[model samples]
Target: MIISAPSASEVRMSVNKSLSSRIAFIVSLLIVSVAWSGAWAAGWSPAAPMLGPRSLHSATRLANGNVLVAGGFYITTVWNFPTAAEQYNPSTNTWTSAGTLLRGRRAHTATLLQDGRVLVTGGESTTSTLAQAELYNPATNSWTEVAPMISPRAFHTAVRLQNGKVLVAGGAPVNSATNAAELYDPATNTWTAVPSMSSARKQHSAALLGDGRVLVAGGYSATTPFWSSAEVYNPATNSWSSVGSMSTARVLFPLVVLPSGKVLAVGGNSGAGLPPSVDAFDPATNTWAPVAPMGIGRYVHTATVLANGQVLAAGAYGRDSAELYAPATNTWTSAGVMSSTRGEHTATLLANGKVLVTGGSGGSGHLATADLYSPDVGSDLGSALGSGLVQADTCAATNDSTPACSAGSTAPDRSFTWTAPSSGTFTVSTTGSSFDTVLSLFDANTGAALGCNDDVSASTFQSSVAVTLTAGRQLRIVVDGYRTRCGTLTLNIQ
Candidate 1:
């Protein structure tokens, strides 16, 4: 948990100023986890239990670094159910009961509004699907009923749009699949009917693209089919149109938008049944490509994008397993496993640079256990923090000395070193403000280009480059600028 840094003279001005204080904070936070066994295998461990089990629920990160977990069934009794809510605090590794919902439900959706409130809508209760909607205020830890959707739904998808309104789409209404879509405005706390989808689907995946439209894909349909067809919703016009479909149709798994602007469809059930294969879709081209397959076949698992640009997938039913995907090489590598086997569990990426994976259907049944995924850290791993950006030239004190790169720009370049893995492939993922930044991977001992994002196709940032690590090897990552918002990288072994 100790993160030692170079001597003060060797540190960047930005990193040195608050270095001691930040180090102390990170170290302190690291010690908060008391149950560190199986939790560590999942890369990190969860610090505390929320008031309830949250399978098939939704958790949204708020602007303040707190996560709002809402609306999922609580297995209170075989004959009764509990409608509850909670919030997780990373700084304290604890959970506090947030509030009670209007209805006891599961498979609902929650979206964090730009104003910092959470809007929760629709899920199935023991008795029926619900059309009720409510808003939770983190500051007050309370909930207020909002306008309900036109359709009672469970297993729907809700995404916040750039325009500031939330979009709720297809799921089961009452007992059948639905093609309906609705929009919720926090400004007025009202719901408006929108153009219905071309398909009736439940358990489908939806993502807001960079262009401000919603990309809707794969889910189960009543026609005895799992759909591969996909569509896009134009918020400006309140309409939907067919887009490219996934290579394979899946439901109850995960589809995440990568930092690179490509959508990754991973680990889900095809109509044929659950499949372990992962695929990537490029909206620019509306095409799909086969990438790596997950080490474990999982349906009902969770996928989260880390700040460093790697996607972490955890918790399938029988398996207490998890894995990381590096889009750079279109490959998958096993990650540290979770403490408990979970399906239909919730995994959320908290604002504090750690992922909080919580409550789900453990193999034995509903579970209250939770865990976290801490990116593996090592000297080599630290070296990866600098990849994917441009660097300026450096001037030495004398002509005989090697010139160094210039310091302090909006996108300050990065540099790091890591010993190569003995028998596995390794990758470095990056995040920075420069939209078109460049990445270069170099042998740490000798500055040689091993591979790079620039060497790949255009528009590749938030990417990874795969190379086999020798018994003991090191690599350096460099960004050509400074002053960027996000400029971190993660090293992965697959």
Candidate 2:
């Protein structure tokens, strides 16, 4: 997608940057895809694909636990902007048409209002930048035109304030960037002009801080050098103030608030190219500090705050690789590679804690494919199995007989709590053990047997059991030895 600028000169410069980036992306698409093809890690599984292909779209999770995805650009012989919208039901794992937008556009912003409605603001239509705005009511699954923005804008940032108003700031009207800011009050369905930002920028990132202030940072601008500067908006005074600048200037990135109330600016284009650098903003100190870089440089991607407080950054210009950031440790870990190499996609954290990644452009062109990522829960269990463990013959005294070991050993056992990563048949094996082993799986809450195994064959003492599990299901795994024998053993779950 092209970055919107306010002036003709800025527009030309922005287009040139976009074109060069696209050319480089297209040239490296195949190489990147091939490199990530077999690198898929655990916790990621294919979800139902979207009805149509799209990129630079919006995805919002509704209060009812469903997700609404709307308006984006696709490609055929030429760029095709679609007005179509759809809803995804996490309960049923299905997608249904929500409706169509009054105006088809891309590079827009959607904010979830407090009243349970979604506000969609200005974006670039097929022919021109648009000032039009609309709202989606989940109650009726319908769309209605609302008051338009103060000016035509694209690649802007919209943040829902604590008082139930949305603050939209820093976007390009047609070709040049604008510092103009506005507020949309859902209670009255009106737009009010707010104080402009200190810098004219587009493709920027904005997030609401814990203290009821909005933070805007790192965007593309024609008037500024580097564009690394940041500013904060105080709703109480209706004023904007400059804050500490990031070490790296960036655009087309994501800014997310951590559980600790710190804001993190992820990887983005830095004029020269995409940078892996990330920055964390301390609201109390009003300072920016450099954090750990990502495994790969990326832009036009999505960074989602997970239920566990970790951030999941997925996709890139043409990369399918995904990674996770742990604020507690200030480190990054590979989440996994997606099923497709995509960029400009949207990632929404569902109510169930699984992240749903939607359509985006890929090496093959616009993609309809989607993926679901299940974060590793009960990681301690995995860590325990990484090394050998000595089984205690303590279960016999407690009369634990739910697994029903054929040898009838009240052998000492170890039990661990594990949440199923996804719904499917998984093999639970005790293949590396010093003695005959018995493995059992049970519902964590109900204490009911789901599966048990005493041995895979008469020729082996190790046991293996395959059990079907539902995604997010909590269960207990009991590792015990057959008869009175107990020794060091290792467990594997796949």
Which is the leading candidate under lDDT?
Answer: 2
- lDDT string for model 2 (101-189, tens) is 99999999999998888999988888898899999998888999999988889999999999999999988766589999999999888
TM-score of predicted model 2? 0.73
Off by over 4 Å in 1: 1-42, 76-80, 377-494
Off by over 4 Å in 2: 1-42, 379-494
Best by TM-score: 2
Compared with the true structure, what per-residue lDDT tens digits does model 1 show for residues 140-177?
88888888888898888999999899999999765579
**TM-score to true structure, per model:** 0.70, 0.73
